[model samples]
Target: MAKLIMVVEDNDLNRKLFCDVLKAQGFEVKPIADGNEVLSAAREISPDLIIMDIQLPGISGVDLIEAAKKETSLKDIPVLAVTAFAAKGDEEKIREAGAAGYLSKPVSIIPFMNAVKELLPG
Candidate 1:
């Protein structure tokens, strides 16, 4: 079965781009626009991977990642955090929050897919 990836991004364009690319790569994708809905959706779907955007409404991706890591059922799922604000030490902060990987905004297809493949179990 194709791996299921949940994409949690607030930007419509970014979300669409991520979902389109993942779908084209033969992966199943669940696209979400609201930060508030991520946890519930994650728990319900138990996706193989989560593509998280650091800036989101209601809750930040860092907080969500930390929260997910604390959940026994969701801890093992890897999160690939995507952020437009690529400030210094941001990657480290996201990683410290329990993201398995990090990608800056305007992500290239090769690296984006590479990160996804690296995180997902084959």
Candidate 2:
């Protein structure tokens, strides 16, 4: 079966771009536009990987990923922290939040896909 990926991003264009890229590369993509909605969907879907945007409405992606890591069911799913706010020390903070990797925006397609491939290798 094709691997499933869950994307948590608020921006319309970013979400579409991520989905389009992953789908075109044959990965099944589930796009979540709200940080608040991610947990419930993640519990139901149990996606292989989660690409999360740090700045979000209601909850920060770092906090969400940290929460997910605390959960028994959700902890194993690797979260790749994707953010436009790649400020100093943010990468360390993101990693401390339990992200398996990091991708800065605007994401270069090749590196982004390469990271995904390495994370969820078939």
Candidate 3:
């Protein structure tokens, strides 16, 4: 079966772009536009990987990552943080928050695919 991916992004354009890219890569993509719905949506979707955006409306992506890590069922799933704030120390912050990988926006197709590939088992 194709791997399922959850994209938690507040921006419509970014969310759509991520969904389109993942879909093209043959992934079953679930896009969540609201930060408040992330946990419940994740529970329902049970995605293999989560591509999260940092600057969310309600809960920050970093917080969500930490929360996911604490959950028994969701903890095993890798979370790749995709953020526009590629400023100094942002990558480390995401990593400390328990993200498996980090990708800076605007994400190039190749790099984005590569990141996803790394997270998935062969």
Candidate 4:
């Protein structure tokens, strides 16, 4: 089966671009705009990987990742925190929040896909 990647992003354009790229590469994409619903959705989907936008409405992506890490059912799925914020210490904060790695936006297709492959290599 194709790998399932759950994407939590608020921006419509950015979400579309991210999901489109993944779909084009033959991966199933679950694009979510609300960070609040991420945990519940993640539990249902049990995705192979999760990519999230750090800046979001309602609950922040980092907090949601922390919550995901706490949940036994979702804890093992690799989460990649994707943020446009390139400020100092952003990557460290992302990792500290329980993400396996980080991806900065606007993400290039090759590197983005490569990150996913590294996390869920076939």
Candidate 5:
């Protein structure tokens, strides 16, 4: 079966781009704009992987990752943090929050796909 991917991003354009790219790559994608609903949505979808944006309107992505890690059902799924903040220490911060990997925003399709592929089984 095709892997399911959950994209939690607030930006309309970025969300659309991410969904389009993942769909083109033949993965089932669920795109969500609200950070508040991340945990519930993830639980319901049981996604194979998650791509989360750090800066969000309600709960921050970092907090969501930390929460997901504590949930037994969701903890095992890999989460990739995608953020616009590419500052020196941001990667470390995201990792500390329980993200499996980090990707800077305005992400290139090649690297983005590579990151996703790394989390998914071949």
Candidate 6:
């Protein structure tokens, strides 16, 4: 079965780009445009991986990742943080929040896929 990936991105172009790329790679992609909708959508979908955007409409992706990590049902799911913040300390903070992998935007196709593959379960 194809792995299900949930992409939480507020930007229309980015969301479409992610979904298109994941789909082409044979993964099932669920694009969530609003941060507020992520948790409930994740619970319902039970996606294998989550591609989270750091700056979001409602809540920060770091906070969302931290929150998801606390939920028993969602804790095990791998989170791949995609952010525009490439500052020296930012990656560490995102990692501390519980992202299994991190990629900066605008992400290159190969590296993005590599990060996704590395985070997905076998």
C-alpha RMSD values across all candidates: 0.6, 0.9, 0.9, 1.0, 0.9, 0.6
Off by over 4 Å in 2: none
Off by over 4 Å in 4: none
How big is the positional error of residue 31 in model 4, measured in Å on the Cα after superposition? Answer: 1.0
lDDT of 2 by residue, 35-120 (tens): 88999999999999999999998789999999999999999899999999999999999999999999899899999999898888
Model 6 Cα shift for residue 92 (angstroms)? 0.5
TM-score, cand. 3? 0.95
Residue-wise lDDT of candidate 4 within 1-122, one digit each (tens)?
A: 99999989999999999899999999999999988889999999999999989999767888898999999999999998899987899889889989997988878888998898889846
Evaluate residue 72 in candidate 4 and report its C-alpha lDDT on the 0 to 100 scale.
97
TM-score of decoy 4: 0.96
How many collisions between residues are there in candidate 2?
Answer: 0
Every candidate's lDDT: 0.96, 0.93, 0.91, 0.90, 0.93, 0.96
Q: Report the C-alpha lDDT of model 1 over 1-122, residue by residue, as the tens digit.
A: 99999999999999999999999999999999999999999999999999999999878999999999999989999999999999999999999999999999889999999999999986
Q: In model 2, what lDDT does residue 74 have?
A: 95
Error of 6 at 17 (Å): 0.5
Candidate 5 lDDT score at position 25: 92
Model 2: lDDT of residue 53: 94
lDDT of 5 at 12: 96
Q: After superposition, how far is residue 17 of candidate 3 from its true place, in Å?
A: 1.1
